[model samples]
Structure formats: C-alpha cells, structure tokens
Target: MLLHFISDLIRNPELQRQFSRDPEDTMRRAGLSEPQREALHKGQLEPVMKHLRAELASLELFAVVWVKAVVQVGSTQPGIAAPGSTLALQVLGDFFTTGAFAVVKLEGADLPAVTRSVENPGQRGSVLSCTLDVPANTPMGVYDVVVVNPDGHYGVLPKAFRVE
Candidate 1:
C-alpha cells in the first residue's frame, strides 16, 4: 500500500504539490504505516527506497529537486550566463552530494559536469551548488538542466537558463 502510494506520488506532480502543503494528512489518507509516515515527514528516503527496491526487482527512481535559483557564480540575479563560463545553480533537495552530477540539455548539445559545493556542507541549508559549463558554441537560447543522483533518480529544471 505504501509502495502504491509512493508510486502515485512520484508520477503525479499535482499529488506532490498537495503532499508538500499537507504531508501528515496526505500520508494518513494514503494508509502508510506509522514508521513510513514519520520517515516521510522528516524527509528521510533510505527506508522508503529500501521498501520500493524490494517491490521492484530493479528500479530507477525519479525524484524532485526544489531548485531555488539558477545564476552565475557571483551574481544574485537569475538567468543569462556567458557561454563557456561557469554557472551556479542553487537547489534544495536531499539527493545532493559530491557524488551527484548534472547535465544541461541545450537544444543542440548536452553539458555534463560534476557538482561542486560553494558553501561548507554543514553551514548552509540543504542548498547545493552545481556547476554548468555552457559551451562556447551553444546556441543562444533557453535550456533545461537535469540533475541525476547516484541512485539514478533525476529531476529537471525546465527552460532553466539562457545563454547570452
């Protein structure tokens, strides 16, 4: 029952939105066990993923990354970065770590790079700094950046930035 609820939550963005607003009510209505409900309320994933993995022989989980902003390394404003320069994407999610990676899916190209930390891990909130290397020849247009975690779960920032 918990697995079914989780699957629905993953596939439906509307449900996710509602869950964010009222997690306790959502989990209760979904009939999750006490432990599972508590785990979710605390933003813990290990136990939930363990149960999910057991149900499916193999799985590639798809998750969400709450992107706070996408801007240049030193700029506070969002959007518009130079080609061949580094950009900083501030994101809030539990799946971020040194092991995570990202890809900028531009119209004609894909930029994949390892993520780096701009602030000390224990100092700031759950915000992570991902590096984006906009190619010199990348078309001057908006692009979507997708972040993939070590567990194969991914989240995308649709039309996240523009190259100038």
Candidate 2:
C-alpha cells in the first residue's frame, strides 16, 4: 500500500499539488498509516525503502522516475501461455496518457528476451491492453515483464507470467 501510494504521488500531478497544500489530509485520504504519514511528513525515505525492501538510492530513483505497472492475468485470462501464442495483457499503471507508447519485453534468465511493441495502445483509465505475440522459439520459463515507457522511464515486474 505504501509503494502504491508513492507511485500515485509520482504519477499524479494533482495529488502532488494537493500534498503540497495539505500533506496530512492527502496522506490521510490515501489511507496511509501513522508511521508512513509521519515518515513522509518528515521527508524521510528510510521507512518507505524498508517497506519496499529496496535500497535508499534505488528507491529514490524509482520514486522520481518509475510508475508501478501490474500485469493482470489468471482470473479472466490465462497467466501461462505456450510458445507462439498470443497473450492478451492488461498493464495497470499511470503515465500511459495520450500519445504514450510502451515497449514490453518478456525476459528470463539465460534466455534471449522476447520483445513486443504496444502500438496504438488500448487504454481504459490507467489500464493499457495489448496482444503480445510470444515467439515460437521462446524458452519455457517464468518471465519478467519489463515495460519501457515513452518518457524513457522503465519498470520491471518480476515473475509476471510463464511460457510453457
């Protein structure tokens, strides 16, 4: 929840403005805990970094640049796909506004990455949906979903899905 709140702040300018005007009310409305609010109020990143299990430096960078993207699968769609199949993916994140594009990659250890372009992206609110063609020769393993945003910021969601 803390990470999500941070992502919201990074992606939404209105929220940032609101935070600057009234931080306590903004944090309270965001449902942040007392410790989280206090830490943020004091301009401390240590507690946030600890909650994310990330180093301070990297967290700082992420807070400035990256928006968290979550790939939706399993409930309404298959999370696992065979090679050569098309995976219908819905990536939930901010900053995917007008004229934005993303380069989505399926990356696995010791395997060549499978890259797909999300051109003419279909967006509903913060969700961007696209059909990604999994290459026939792709290896069988869990793959991380790496999205490179139009503004050059990128984020990796590890173990997002699997190729059978």
lDDT top scorer: 1
TM-scores, each model vs. reference? 0.44, 0.40
For 1-164, candidate 2 gives per-residue lDDT tens digits of 56768889999999999999999999999988887788777786776666565423475547443333322221213457788877666655544443333333454333222333333332323444556667788788876655445545544556666778
Worst 10 residues of 1 by lDDT: 68-77
lDDT of 1 by residue, 59-152 (tens): 3222222222222122122456787787766555444444556666776678775567634322224445666677787778776766555555
Error of 1 at 12 (Å): 31
lDDT values, one for every candidate = 0.61, 0.57
Where in model 1 is the C-alpha error above 4 Å? 1-78, 118-125
* Backbone clashes in model 2, listed as residue pairs: none
